[model samples]
Target: MGCCNAVRLNKCDEYPTQYRTDFIRTGYRPLPFSFKECIKSAFYANNETGNIWTHFIPFLFMVHRAYNVINQFEDLTDPINFGYYVHSIGVTYVLIASTIAHTFCSHSELCFRKCYSVDRAAIIMQGCSVQLVFELYICPPSCYVAEGMGRNSHVILTLYCVLSTIMFCSSVHPRLGRFQRFLATLPFGIGSIMINFSCAVRYLYSSNAIESTCFGTTKGDHVLFYFHLTSACLAIFFYVTKLPERWYPEKFDIVGSSHQIFHIFVAISLYFQNRLIEHVTAEAKFKIETGELLREPLASACSQTVGIFLLTFITVHSVVALYYWKVQPTIQICKPPEKKE
Candidate 1:
């Protein structure tokens, strides 16, 4: 949205009325745009310009962090280190999927649904990945559902996928109320927060609770965990309220939108979470170097994480495809808004 001249922008009347709902824009990208055009449009000014870059920039930044992790850390094959690798993948995929969806969503009505369908699936997987990381690396053992609670992780992951599938269907089936969609996605967030809260309770309240790594060595206080939770809740509030812009739509069509603010907070949240893991990993690595800790590789957790991603990935998109095939015929073109004159 930095550009003063926008060659690809078109009036809102030129696109579906859905573009007008809860969103005000000076112009939107033309419909049925090519993928190549979508990529090229990221450089130009349009309604979704900020949305595309907000997540994409963080995606690139995380890629750089991944590179740093590979070079600076030893015992790279250790499962404790490897589990965080899995979390990084989830963080990376979520941003990339959001960027892709934002970039290509204006292509057509079908395109919009398909793009966001993929985005929702990616988000569900991210939640599952977060759970896996918490179970294996972060949570103190004193927490009720801490590490070694493999069964709890499985049940929570299954519930997330089931509710997420309903949410996926809601994205494709236009008749589903917004409240229905909200309800479907609520379980995943609630499940994740419950696990985190258990850790928080153990850390904050229990006199015996110790901040420790998976290697069984106690560490310092859990500052990063608290920061992660704070940033995450801030991001969620922005997402739910659609703030500032909802109060003043005309002033925020491009740069200062709520979605953009949400993306920034999400990035910060991820940074805090990453640093928390890195701290634990650093301590574990030191012990390993001194011949005090052995790398177990926890192959089971790795396998389970991969399974959750594949199952959710296939289930969500499959329902999306079926719904589109059945409903495409009934979908109608946008009628231009009538002129006042």
Candidate 2:
């Protein structure tokens, strides 16, 4: 009931319709238009409080993990270690973007749309990063260049990045309806399924695998990989369905919402992924020490160039999306309509 830094709190019903999603229709609080006030609200109780903390806390853990990984493997020349470092960076960005989006989305309708675009871009970037790490692990530089499968995998990943960027950009188009926005995210979901399938196939044919430390060879590793896949699937299900909260909206307003559950599952899935990465990295190190395998070179120049291009494209796409959604008044939805009879 009291004010947070002289800014009064609002209830679910007070939220603008444009700001309300189907699952989060209530328990909303108004944020001050000022940047400082909106940021200060992160400390106070509100509808987005759970969402903000969920990713914010994880972002801190990610930072710590990144530091540990870099310190442990100071030699970034090792392709596997470098891949892990890049993955950590990607995960950190995802968490921070999610936190910022949830924290300030209530500031205004334009802010909400802009932040939503940033969150989507972060998701796409994280997905690409995951694929990059997995590819580096499963197919080192020599194998990637020598084998047709590796070449095909790289091409597929590049296409996924391009498609995801396009999808996110399209989702923000004013002409695209709400249903289109929902459909825009479907490609990434499908891409995830395809990626998992590829990993499974590679595991099944481990005898012919180029990498000695292929994941899913051991029964435990297989189970862990499947667990990670299940966690990811569950997160996606909750995100799309907006369950629990969708069934009982106001009851779970400040917490226990579907988005919060999705974030938790995401973290769980990443935990499993980390475990798998650690196991494979250890195995790779043991193999190298035993003279069973040699450390392959890092990604080739062409591969690195492609990666840089994709990163640049994603950056440009996010900038254009923000500009169109926030800075361009003509494209914004808040324009006053002409007088009607």
Cα deviation of 17, candidate 1, in Å: 3.3
Q: If candidate 1 were superposed on the true structure by all CA atoms, what would the RMSD be?
A: 3.7
Across 1-341, the per-residue lDDT of candidate 2 in tens digits comes to 24544555555455554565556655566543566666777777666778888898888987886677567764556555655655676678889988998888766666776777777777766776666666666433234223545556656665676666566655655556675646566866776865576666655555555554343255666676778889999998988888887788577777788889889888878767766766666666667778665555333422453355366446646565666756556634342223467
Q: What value of lDDT does candidate 2 attain over all alpha carbons?
A: 0.65
Model 1 whole-model lDDT (C-alpha atoms): 0.68
lDDT of each: 0.68, 0.65
Candidate 1 local lDDT, 26-94, one digit each (tens) = 657776677777887888876688889999999999989987986886657655566567778888998
| Top-scoring candidate (TM-score) | 1
| TM-scores vs. true structure, each candidate | 0.82, 0.82
| Model 1: pairs clashing at backbone N, Cα or C within 3 Å | 32-107
Cα deviation in Å at residue 70, candidate 1? 1.8
